[model samples]
Target chain A: MSALFEFCLRMGDNTLVLGHRVSEWCGHAPVLEEDIALANTALDLIGQTQMWLGLAADVEGQGRSADDLAFLRDAWDFRNLLLVEQPNGDFGVTMMRQFLFDAWHLGQLETLIDSADDRVSAIAQKAIKEVTYHFDRSSGLVIGLGDGSDESHARMQTALDLLWPFAGEGFEADATDLELAGAGIAPNPAGLRAAFDARVEQVLQRATLSLPESRFAHRGGRTGARHSEHLGHMLATMQVLQRSYPGATW
Target chain B: MTPIAQVWEWLDAVPDPEIPVISVTDLGIVRDVDWEDGTLIVTVTPTYSGCPATSVIAMDIETALRDHGVDRIAIRQQLAPPWTTDWLKPAARDKLKTYGIAPPQPAGGPESCPHCGSANVERISQFGSTPCKAQWRCRDCLEPFDYFKCI
Candidate 1:
């Protein structure tokens, strides 16, 4: 695959997987309002998934469609950020995961708006609006739930600590990433690191949650070199209907 | 024998699949209508990235034009300068209010109740039956309505 195609896959996989995680909250969110909000966010991400993966297929010059890329890929073959595939532990954990991802996701899209590749820029431009709203909603929840009750506050902090390590992967740039960045076809993940960190810190402070001091960072998932155990199980469930029905359409 | 102007007129009659009260032209989704070597091209922008109605709108545009005796049509979806609720025609806003949906308020401003024309409205949910709207309730009239959210 071309570097650009791989780049698109990395982005598409992250969005599709994360979107699936959020969709799991559809009818199960703590409140009706949260249910609607999560579903909306999920839909937005899935739409992004379609755009990115569709581009990936086009760039690959292969017959593969977005559905093929989304459903046929195995856990080890998928290139989503490891952070996105992590289990949705609880409301606090889910919100914290979303908040962390949204911070980086927004930064990535903002920088991508100027990509030399018009297709990439166009998709990012359309998606930035939706991501902006997702960031707002997730950040607002972080502050509200984090500062609300003792249980919420503690859970939020715990969630933050657990998810913090996974965030480092979003900013780690590989050789292909650097090439894309050099060509002005993609944003440098490394370049977005500082801004992402600042935003996350600001939101954490307002939520009264402290940044986790852990310096250890887990790598892989960009190229699907490695992934969390949660990914395989999730894929089994998500791909079941597709694998069984093959070519099924609503 | 149909003119390009006639195609535009036909498109003006194509109602949005989600909100039938407003035509696609009035909803501002139809950005441009032009002809290319005897083919009709209609440029459209989706209100929200995830709005499921966009495909339906494109098909509706095609079907509407075809029904008007236009043989060839190309519906293009553009993303730059993304669609905003502000594009809704002033007249369309009135139509939305009459249809029981609150038009989007100015950015960061509270939405007014469509039922009672009061500002005592609180957002009940960030999403409604569709992606383009939010569920809101009026404190005055105690009626729940859909508010076209600021994109």
Candidate 2:
């Protein structure tokens, strides 16, 4: 696959997987406000996925549409960050995960606003506004819950510790990333690390939470080398209707 | 050949699917209207990427144009200079307030309750029933209202 197509898939799949995970909280969130907020965030991410995947399909010169790319691909064929595909453990965990991802996501989109490709730049331009709102909400929640009560603080810390290792994969560059970065189509993943770390440190400090000492990075999802067992289950549910019917539409 | 002004006027009659008080033109989604050869091209920008109303709004535009005897209509989606609350027409802001939804404010929150015009308001949530709105309640009136959040 071409580097551009791979880059698009990576961007699209990150949002797609994370959107699905957030949408899973629609009726299940601890409070009504949180439930609505999660759903809205999920919607925005899915919308971005449409643009990214649509571009990917066009670049591939394949007849596949965005929906086809989203539903037809198996877990091994997916290219999302391992952080996004991890389970939403609890309300605190979900917010922590979102905050971590949002920090990096915001930085990524800001840099992409100047991308070499007009399409990539346009999508980023549109998505950055929504992601800004997402970051605001997620980061605020992380702070509130982390510093709220003894239990909440403990939970937030645990969630951070659990999710921090997965965060590294987002900054690890592979050949696809290198080619895209070299071509100016996208930024090198490694270059985004400083901003991500700064944002995380600021938020975690205000939240009264400690960052995990180990930066031991997890690898595979973005490379399609391997994915956690959770991904297969998610894909099974997400692609079920399309896989079963083959060409169903509303 | 219909005049572009007349086509825009017809589009101004198409009500937003979610907020019926204001037309798509008033909502600032219709960015341009012109005739490209035989096709009537209407450029639109979505209020929010995932807004379900986007497709409905496009369909509504098509239906309204077709009813006006325009056969070849193309709806183009524009992403650059992304849609913002600043695009909302001033008249539309009044319409939104009068319709009980607070208009977008520069301060990032509702200035007051749309119903009671009370300045004492608290945000209930950063999100509401729709992607473009947020939930707020007036402390004075004790009524919850949706605010068209500044994007």
Candidate 3:
């Protein structure tokens, strides 16, 4: 119920669900190197999710372990944004999703490093290097495809358009964010939006891809608890082991 | 021998989960295998921070240590001094090649095909089965192979 734990869940759950989604590409990625990278990046973020959520569970004293929080929770209980829950349609679509998230994540982490909440700040600082490289690799692909042949360019463009609406949730400030913002312990997503936009725009320009002029932006990804069908499938895979063999340890 | 020396000898045989021929010791990641105070402390540097194999690595190390009747084991991860390709033993390189996945090489700004020993290899995609490798293809051989991605 405390603001600190809630904020940590907001952060941790996002990575947890997204990492679960990415890890599905293991042994299935179009190429060997990509499979490794996707799975590894997924590993990195999922590891962080475990830490922050465990810390959150400890602080909350809710009798819930990190594993419980991760696997036992239902779709409505998950706090990840809808964008992360979207299915990996294709290589281009997955790259676009990653690029969009990376841009916003980079901005948030850049500010999070200065957060008064030192644990989150330290984690953010340590994670920055990894995310930066992830962004670079994703961005390179974005540009490469965006500027490539007509089919490739058009497909990436379509992916860009489809994923744009989900980007809005990363910038929305809720009561929890406002509370932590007051403590200088939470990142100001709204503040980071301008920078995120600038960085993403620059990359999009280099890619020579045009953003569709859609005035419509989707909201309620966090609070509404509505999600794509993809999330239920993801949770099914991720939650099975924990649910089946309760309290199983390493 | 002291417990430290004993632990090292015991650990020298633990094979990597993915790369079976290369022992953790041969990877230069098993920094210190010793008894500190009452517990066995095994220090390790990850080949890369998010190595999916790390959990397995830790599990393997713990199992190996405990199987030798050494309990109270703690695996401390050290990431401050980064890992490089140079840490892999020369024998491991040959082992990797024999296994069909080439060993890591310096980036040299571009990747080379591990199968045909040509510089004409190009990246096919960035996501591979694991984080430590990249999917590359040999233009000459037209064979897809894993490039031990540089950290």
* Best model number under lDDT: 2
The best candidate in terms of TM-score: 2
Tens digit per residue, CA lDDT, model 1, B64-128: 88887788888888887778887888999898889998888786534688788899878787778
**Interface Cα RMSD in Å, per prediction:** 1.3, 0.6, 3.5
TM-score of each: 0.96, 0.99, 0.78
State the lDDT of candidate 3 residue by residue for A92-128, as single tens digits.
9999999999998888888888889767776676567
* B77-109 per-residue lDDT for model 3 (tens digits): 765345566788788777777676767766522
DockQ of each: 0.72, 0.87, 0.27
lDDT for A125 in candidate 3 is 63
Error of 2 at A40 (Å): 0.5
The CA lDDT at B144 in model 2 is 98
Regions of candidate 1 where Cα sits further than 4 Å from its true position: none
> What CAPRI grade goes to candidate 2?
high
Residue B65 in candidate 2, Cα distance off native in Å: 0.6
- TM match of model 1 to true structure: 0.96
For residue A137, model 3's alpha carbon misses the true position, in angstroms, by 3.7
User: How well is each residue in B40-75 modelled by candidate 2, as lDDT tens digits?
Assistant: 999999989989899999999999999989999999
Candidate 2 whole-model C-alpha lDDT, 0 to 1: 0.94
What fraction of the true interface contacts does model 1 reproduce?
Answer: 0.67
Better of 1 and 2 by lDDT: 2
